[model samples]
Target: MAQRGFWIPLSLILVFASFVSLWWPGPNYGTDFRGGTEVEVVFTKAVEAHTVRQTVESLGYQTPDVVQVQDVKSPSHFIIRVQEVSSVTDATKEQLKKALCLTTDAAAAVADEHACPSNARATEVTFSPGGDKISTRYDSTPDLEKIKEQVRSVGGINLRAAADNPQIVNQRDNHVEIQLQSKGDQLMDGLRDKLGADTVPAQPLKVEWVGPKAGKQLRDSARNSVAIAIVFIMLYLAFRFDLRFAPGVVVASVHDAMVIIGVFVVLRKEITVSTIAAVLTIVGYSMNDTVVIYDRIRENLSKHRGKSFWDIINMSVSETLSRTILTAGVTMLSMLAFFVWGTGVIRDFALAVVIGIVAGTYSSIYVAAPLTEWIDKRMTQRLGAKKKRPSGKRRAKAVTGKPAEAK
Candidate 1:
């Protein structure tokens, strides 16, 4: 017989580890679940993640979760995640105005000052009104192209020349308008200040915000879905097999889920909708594995009637071992590829699958089979005790020393 002495201890340890991991820091929920903003920024030139983090942090905001958006066509892209803000604050607007305003000599042409900010070369420094729309004025005809390029560095989008133009002698003729989108644009000015005016402009490719209520709804839905799935699995197993087999299958499935979730908790990976989907998928996968082994055990029961229950189980597992390995191996390889090369949610989903697959395989072999065998043994013992009990008529016949009539 295979020695299972270590199985109980190992299972206990794993359960304890999972408990601790979940109780301490807990699983790290992503923007999808926790309610936050996700911004995808595409720069004209490649920027390092550390530099981005440093720049974002310097702007009086928490460091965002940053990941490089890897693609052959768009190599200079990054995705940053932070808490959501409803609108830009007045203080942030003022900072942006100061950063965009350039102090240049009255005689300096707009084209000459476009390359870099000349603090020492400037004869006068002026700023537009600090409001939703900011406009800058200059004595000479400002290079609209250069001004637009500069505005872009500070998250200024939809740039246009203001309607007001002065052709009067010794008066400013250039006026430019800037429109700001979100609070994130406030960082643009800070970034320009740090990276210099010559740096390539950063453009917002996508922005996603999840409200707290919406996040709560999503979390509740994810929980309900998982619970419903487990219930359905238990019902299906009980209907398909003997009641004795259902407990083991359900326990194994739950064990697989907990272990997979525990891994994410330990790793501090974000739990997104994709993660929930992966977990549910793993439940089905694990149930399938357990069912296959259970089917084999059932088939062997009549064929190996004289064999001990333990022997039968062992033989069944041995017979199906190759199939189990092949199936899990192929699936694991595919998930591994996704984990290694995939990006964003796809990568996280693959990671969850990888963990679930290992846990499921282990539970199927060690957890489900042993549990079924134990339950079957307890049931047999109970039935045997009942059968060994003498009936009331039998007891009376023995006391009276007379044989009972045959039924």
Candidate 2:
């Protein structure tokens, strides 16, 4: 038989790494959920997140936040958020696109500087408010025709082009600001066709950006959430099984979470606020699978005391293999739909769920159940050999031997 103890050390290592990242994650969320520039656009028709993401990508930005933020009182809503980075020049183009798409009073808040002072060294182009005497930022001028083509496709108009001179702020930290023309709000209303129908409009003039305040809150909340979740799962497992089984399940859950987070870090996927929510959701999902497998293990142990530890564990996993596979398949199908059809905001959320489900399934069979059996065997050997307690009235039956009552 394979040595069951071998998996415990690996489980512990994975859990420790994941717990560290919960507090010290490197990526930051977008302003929409985290509070940055609120660019609200009302399209000529309904739009989808993928199209918006594509348009933004074409404009030379990374994926922006596209969420349905609504005012409880008003039927009207809008999609809000910032730009992504492609090439260096695209960043400036992104800012300009954001300025033109504005449909909120917040757009007017952008500075009219020729180019942002802080970004001067990095950005190849400059930004200025749309008009004459606009200060130029970059040495090389961008193709205005290309810019106009993409802008028009995404429902952008009002052509008064200038250099990509980005206005700089003295915030002493990293951030971008955008200002819309007086027609900004109306302009956004015209571009609503780019935002998908599933998106609900948000209140106008709301500022969205990732600042220190939102960042810290996001960090703390993610940390606290993970801690609380792990604690609760451990408690629940302990209550249902013995304390010995709890450690194994917790290890497996943490392993699943860690592998997902590590992959995200390596992939450099934007870890947004929604990403944290996704992590928490995945944790619960992973625990659910672990619990189901564990339940089977306890049942098998009761039914077959004469079986070897490896046999019992293998049996439990095999018995539930069909259920686990079906459940995982159905859950993944739903997540796949969200991922393929959903917008940028929740795409990460769905991706995280998919990763967690796969990892959870593997850990339940290979990690949790196996580890539980290993520990149980170790405990039984130690106690059964060490103590000479009789098969008497008081002691309950060990998994390996007959219970006192039965004897």
Q: Highest lDDT, which number?
A: 1
The CA root-mean-square deviation of candidate 2, after full C-alpha superposition on the true structure, stands at 16.0
Residue-by-residue lDDT tens digits, candidate 1, 346-396: 888999999999988888889889988899999999999999877777866
Runs in model 1 lying further than 4 Å from the true structure: 45-50, 68-77, 88-180, 183-202, 390-407
Q: Candidate 2's error at 79, in angstroms?
A: 9.9
For residue 164, give model 2's deviation from the true position in Å: 33
Q: Against the true structure, what is each candidate's TM-score?
A: 0.70, 0.53
| Candidate 2 lDDT over residue span 134-160, tens digit each | 222222233334334334443333333
Cα deviation at 73, candidate 2, in Å, is 29
Q: Local error of candidate 1 at 354, Å?
A: 1.7
